[model samples]
Target: MDGTLTINGPKHTDGLTVERQEKPFHPIEHVDARLISLLDMAADSICLIDDHSRILLFNKASETLFGYSAEDVIGQRVDILMPQKYAEHHDGWIARYLETGEHSIIGIGREVQGQHKDGTTFPFDLSVGVAETENGKQFIGVMRDLRARKEDEQRLRSLQTELNQMTRINAMDEMGATVAHELNQPLTAIILYLQAVERKVSKLADRGPITSEDVEQLSDLCGRAIQEAQRSSSLLQRIRSIIEKKEPERTTCDLVEIIRKAHKLSLVGFSATDVFIDLSAPDDLPPVSVDPVQIEQIFLNLLRNAFQAMREVEQKAIKISLKIVTDEEDRRDRLQVRFQDTGSGIPDSHRKNLFKAFDSERRNGMGLGLAIARSIAQNHGGSLDLAPFDEAQPGACFLLTLPIASSPSDESEPKTESSESMDGSQ
Candidate 1:
């Protein structure tokens, strides 16, 4: 009876009793530390929660992303890491998933907002998975920050917008040149016919018994027609100059004379006759080496803008002042021209984009006057800017600055002459 019992495979042993015993079974832990450690080493944040939505496992990446330690979040409700609104309804969603097993966010990746320990929310990519364990069902979520990707997308959109704007500007330039060419032909013909009619009427009056009043009225009408035709032609010339790609012809000329001619020409319309112009410049000022026509055009634009701005004002005046500016070393470096108008000052909202193409505050404005004027100024080694408004003066002021030519021979290269042919009678 004291001898040990022995059992053989499918056989009985003589002179011994045999017995078989079964070993007890133990269930594995719901979370394996080794597996969690592997997930912790990943770049994306990994988190695990139990059936009750309590955080069961938090990896190193998760700790860093949520700005919390594992000890702070373990056994805590998983909703603490989500936005308040999402947290409030997250439990119901989990319950629905467990009851119906219908896929909503489970087993799918999507974009969502993640809340950090500091309570700041940021965009993230979230992918969730469900697992069944001896302890019950659990959820595993992987989160990746989207801040960098979003910034890249924003930059791309900005570049696309800039490209679109440049394309529009190029198209406008082409259209403007074509329109100017088409208009110049009809304008030239109109002027020629009007001139011929004036001559015929004069000859008829001399041979017939035409009354003095009739002759005077007819002459006045003919003169006004001719003037209007010339004005139209000049406007076309200005449009052509603005869209012209060739270098302008530069010559030595007096800036004062240019200003006077611009002042006179800008007054041709009824809207500008009531506006008085005051000019000031030093008599000993040196001649500027520039395109006289281009300079006059700049003055004309400035004066026209001033007149338009002052149309409703009781006091209508434009003050033009010129001075030679010297550098720090006392060497003559620039010429400064200031045009100040007694009119309604530019609004603060309009100041920033004042020189941008196609941006204007006037109802009948083309929005190119200031843009082209500034461009011409910059092309001539100069700048045009709205001067600071004087509180006492109560008007708008513009300053034009140009670099003085170093020498008389500092000229632009000669450009090829281009001309258009049009029949005046047609």
Candidate 2:
């Protein structure tokens, strides 16, 4: 009889007998350990899920990205990491993939929202892969948080907007210069023609025995026409000088007169139904050394700002008062004009940057008015500042000071015979 030899353990005497035994084999143990180590070392989050959509593995990065611990996420459904809308369709997607091997998002990286442990959602880039394991089919996903990238994008957009605004301002400056240059010749011609017409009208009045009343009326009309024409020419010249950045032509001028002109200009299109203005100036105030046109511009800007600030207020009023102030440090006299408004006061937060260019609080403002006004004052050897806030009265006050013209010619120049005190009200 054919017999097989058995190893010496417990011998069977009937014949030579052999015994065999088999041990359980697990192919994925060592490989799985190595894969988990690699996944944990990755910067992006990595998650592994079974065919049932249950999380089989969650790496250290996934824990950090989702603000969840591995112990909390593993064995749970993967939809917990996704937003509600995405989670609702996630199961159907996996089911369809299982049925038809059609890969819609597999291997394609795309942006999606990831829900955090605290219930907040953030953007992330996700790339998914399908694999066949010894146990079953599974999905592997790699995700990268996009919060930093999104912040960088927002910063870039803000910078671009500022650049665009600066570009627009530069273009406007060039256009203003061109317009002023084009307007100069026509404006001069208009003033000259008006003057010639006035002279001719005056000659006619002297030649004929026109009724005294008619002659006086005609002279009055011609004088007014010539005065308006001259005013227009002066306005154009001021614009040209400003656009060309010419140095201001300083002269001795009545501060009260400049204020009156500026106030009139500021109220051109303003409605008086809800607003009142009171202007007071002393007749004994001395002349100031300043660029009259620039000072007028400053006054106009301040008045316009006050009007706009009080547009929504029920009781709106602006009071302008002029007084002579003496500097204690140098014993020098200066003229100060105070503009007080009964409107919304400036907040402490806005006061620091109120005169800074491009830092306006008003929605439709360019934030250049106060800056330009202050610059003009400084150039005139004067200063513009906001007066101290008075809690008792809720409003804003602006004080402008200019050095008094002390030249011998200013003192000897016939004190303007006009001692008319102005108390304008509207």
CA lDDT, every model vs. true structure: 0.70, 0.72
Model 2 lDDT tens row, 297-410: 788778767777788888887888777678778888788888898888888877888777679574236266677678778867789998988997778899999988863344
Off by over 4 Å in 1: 1-245, 268-270, 328-332, 358-367, 406-426
lDDT of 1 at 68: 95
Candidate 2, TM-score vs. the true structure? 0.43
Best by TM-score: 2
Question: Model 2, stretches more than 4 Å misplaced?
Answer: 1-244, 272-274, 360-366, 407-426
Which digits, one per residue and each the tens of the lDDT, describe model 1 over residues 1-426? 534344231112233322322112222346577787798789999888876677877889989889999989887888889898777457666655665587689878899888999999988999999899766778889888898999998896566445434533553464565555555765776677677767768887787877787667677767766776776776656545544544468887888877866665555343465666777775555577788767777887787677777878998877777776764655756888888888888878777888776785642362566776787688687789988768988778899987665433432443232222211111
For each candidate, what TM-score against the reference? 0.41, 0.43
